[model samples]
Target: MLGPDPRTTLVWALLLDWLGQLLILALIVWIPPALDWSIGGTQLAGQYPWILFCVLLYPLLGWLFGSYTVLHWRRLPMLVLIQRLLLTAAATLAAVAIARWLINPGEEVWLVYRRVQVVWLVSLSGWSLLVRLGLRQGMLLPDTPRLLLLAGDEERDRVLQAWRRVPQRERLRPIQPQQLEAELSRLDVAMVLTLSPKIHRDPALRSVFQHLETADPRWIRVVSPERLFEAMQERLPPALLAEQGLNYDDLPWAVTFSIQAQLKRAADFLVAALLLLLTSPLIALAALLIWWDDRGPIFYVQERSGWLGRPFTVLKLRTMAVQSPGSPATWTQLGDRRITRVGGWLRRVRLDELPQLLNVLNGEMSLIGPRPERPELEEELEQHIPHYRKRHWMRPGLSGWAQVCAPYASSIEDSDLKLSYDLYYLRHFSTWLDLMILFRTIKTVLKAGGR
Candidate 1:
């Protein structure tokens, strides 16, 4: 149902969450004083720094943990509430630990700190849960603002099934052609028409939608069912690619050629340089381990496809024995015998990719984008997957949307799925998306589940 825009709902949810946290903090201070408890050498006003830290740190953690993502909000209210509470608790503990370490509170202050932190954690979690539950029930109630989906017989069932999976399903009612006008008039309706050549050419249906638009311009939308499926799955289907008139040659070069491209490159270089400096000791340790594994070379270098299908040498810490003279390139399977014990651990922790930061610094890759494929693999994928080569329109990346969302590709089908993620990234390329990918990538590494 077209209740509120997802982005608008997210903004409101965040506002309510922040306000709840603030109110809870205020209560923690006021209620304790009312109980005659000592505040340990500080007045309520003096606690502004802690309050400020909560204000900034909680929301940052929430965003990182997917609390602000709209898809989560579209789930069952109880599920969303539980997820938010857990995330809030985690964030609170982290913020409190960081604060304790940074401030190094004295004994008396430490007592006060522990007391306030416990109260804040409970109050904030409870309050945020109540706020989100209220929002879900009030604004996202499943009885108003109904959605009417229009599609051919073949497409209608697929579209209806998709809508049924969302929390708004109760408000989604499919209307037959004969009942369209009556239903539209009787309900607070938002109409979604699946785009197709046949539907586009139907003047009568066009007139009906045009009339609806005139009455409520923003309530009527034309969307491709395939695009909807792609979004839901986070992977482009071949049929959707064909239906949407997408072409490999139409790759969004504007993203690569624009001012943001310059900013992206600058960001890449600066972040790469900083990371390389910070990671120098770790890199040295990894190299030592590799060398000590079997007296083999410490670095592995191989040719890979890059921007605009150019070739560049990609570098990694050696993760396998030196190949026999004529061994062919192949995917790394799980528990492959080629992996040395030290190399396996390094790969798990993603230390092997630390060297690719140098590639970022060298302008051969981005800090975030589609991962570069090897030349032979790229050629094979391009042959099997439509528009696969379009991923090269931008610089390949150290970590990407596909890397975060999908497992490593081992076959043509897997490669196709990865390409869909790449296409999604290409279509929606932005600094914010890049940041999200980077955050998810960090989570993946911390869990030691390498792609």
Candidate 2:
């Protein structure tokens, strides 16, 4: 059992998935033609060739959605892949249905082949599942050694203990701080994972890189111990990277801000538009519900701090009972008396903010940025948190880097750390990075990260 190579495994999985889809498509497309039997009386129509085009799409979708990443196969992640398979199957069904409707629309075909359409969907879903499962299982056979070094002894021991509890401990070897230099020389290790910040700063340990270069370069395996564990990771942005010895303030701020902001806003407009379109029905339904509740305005607009301390009215469906009472801006509590039943659900799933799409469209917000806060909260926060106002340097977002990384911000400390992530997004904005944040936000919304 050879352990799967993370880099090459994705490529191979995609190829294999494509091959399986092609074979299944061929069988569906050709077998019907060969049989000369009308599939539910569609008469083996001219539209059968379109199945090839639809089949080619599934593999790319699967790869993009991470339906094929199984290099770190574990029970929970395997279950996640299975769920992705179900979604992929659903998407496949929708795509095929759309294709048929658009390109294969003949009343005779619809009338004759209604039942066969169901069969085709079932078969395609089954085929996709088989490929996904086969690829997942193929990775379970350990062929290569995955030696993960826990650089910090205390942190490493904790992880080592956890892995040992997993019955498959044979696949992992935890290297303590002292043994790191000696182990790197042996050179056949597939992964050298480090998760200890303490280990990263050690001058003696850093010198091991020189020794490793002297050894077999093919034995190249450098795992960021920092990436190996979540607790060890800092959420700081580049501007406040003084602790990490990085200084964004020293660099060209105007060029950096202009380019990054342009990319971020472009992404914001594209994503916000797509999301508004995709969820239009839901937004409509929510709007109707909100109006029915109080016969008041469905969309609530509140003044919130925006880029560079600019004030903007952030949009939301009125979730609170009072239009204006108590403080002008306050955080909604876990069980607030002001919340309606619908409001509670909205807060839970974060649907209340759907109207923010309008804000995004109006250029007041980005789809992904720092969450806009009340001016009152901003003034208070800036006093305590270092560089807290730095978050306002970019437009506030509907969903943000901090919202995905940290759980719902309730306390000042949580908000402060979240500000760090917001600054990070402003500094490192890109289309690809926005996609990553969107993916992370989905997981956060699903509560899949377990907070």
Candidate 3:
């Protein structure tokens, strides 16, 4: 807590950034008329927030992206900060474009928006780099924030004990009741951890909060412990579930039902279709090699668990020598003797799993999810491993968080390691996270790190 409050500085910085944008909006309206380049003579003022919305979205998006975090914002390099801000700007502009399309603004309105956006894109690019660089750097901003824990007398010890356990305890400056007003005036604390609901009942503290409502409420963010946990949620590994007091039952959606799910389905279908098409020639070549390698079948189909514990036949290019009837379903060992020469190469390149794209298209799998297991093996795993069936909560995928993040699982201990990543994925399923897995899968395949 020795330097500028990054969150407070961020607020001041963004206020300045937004003011520049507002001024730019005004100039776009004024400059055209002054230079006699007028188109329909300025209706931007009349458009209100409709036209001003994009300018406003700039800071809101920044907050959403945590561009101004309590700790890391000050330490972020100029290039990294610019990259984050640019992403926010891109998202804002995309919203603007979508809004314009949806509204179908008339010719003059459309022209005004297009011109303003073009100018904004060009000008703001230079603005952040030059004009706002110092502000974002927070070199000129004032005050170092203390981490405040708001607890009544009864709960103060409990709160302090909990606070001491967190790594951020170094930032706790311990503001006494009398010094609260002074701290507020100096903007010395940006976050208040309310450990007790009734702790804010003091007449002075209540007045301070009421003042916050009237003044800039951005400075002091009131955070309940639950809200803090919720913010920290989304990507909890199975290993940490006990520590976090969470269990497999906490993961929502027996079968995920939402727009996010539908979008995921659409993306899986489209990406799988495209990948299947693009890799057809490679798949054919691999199939021919596998046939020639051992005179075995090109495709191997096996019963595997799917979403909601449903059993489905999964398709894959055979990469193992044919097994005898009634052979136990066992994990293939590294450098297993059963793997044919060409099959080993196929596994190494992950080309053997290419046929699973058909499974993805058939809605039995996803482009990214927990890797499914053979039903026989899955039953054994369920018997021995806690929460093993939870992996089947989401649809099986050709590649997944577990598949990419973890190495090949031939042992129960290895499966446990992979399951942790799989649980993390289930906890934090999002479009962005799915895209991350997809990229990692591509990298793995490129590195021939498969099997």
RMSD of each: 4.6, 6.7, 12.0
- Model 3 TM-score on a 0 to 1 scale: 0.50
**Candidates sorted by lDDT, best first:** 1, 3, 2
lDDT of 1 by residue, 127-208 (tens): 7666666665656433234445566666566456544433342344555666767755653555554454445466778766
**lDDT tens digits by residue: candidate 2, 1-451:** 1234444556666666666655654565557657885554424455445545555667645644557644334543556766777676667667767767776766654321445545555565566566556555555333455556655657566555533332341345666566766666565555444445566667866666566556553454554432332112224522223343323453223365567657667766887889899988987888888778877777777888887888988778777785555656666565778887676766767788878898898898888778888888878887777677667766788777778666566777667657756755655556666787787667545543322
Cα error of candidate 1 at position 333, Å: 4.8
TM-score to native of every candidate shown: 0.78, 0.65, 0.50
Score residue 32 of candidate 2 by CA lDDT.
64
- For lDDT, the strongest prediction is 1
- Model 3 agreement with the true structure over 228-303: per-residue lDDT tens digits: 3234322233332444443545554333476777889999899899999999999999989988988889898888
User: What is the C-alpha local distance difference test score of candidate 1?
Assistant: 0.71
lDDT of each: 0.71, 0.62, 0.67
Among all windows of 10 consecutive residues in model 1, the one with the lowest summed lDDT is 163-172
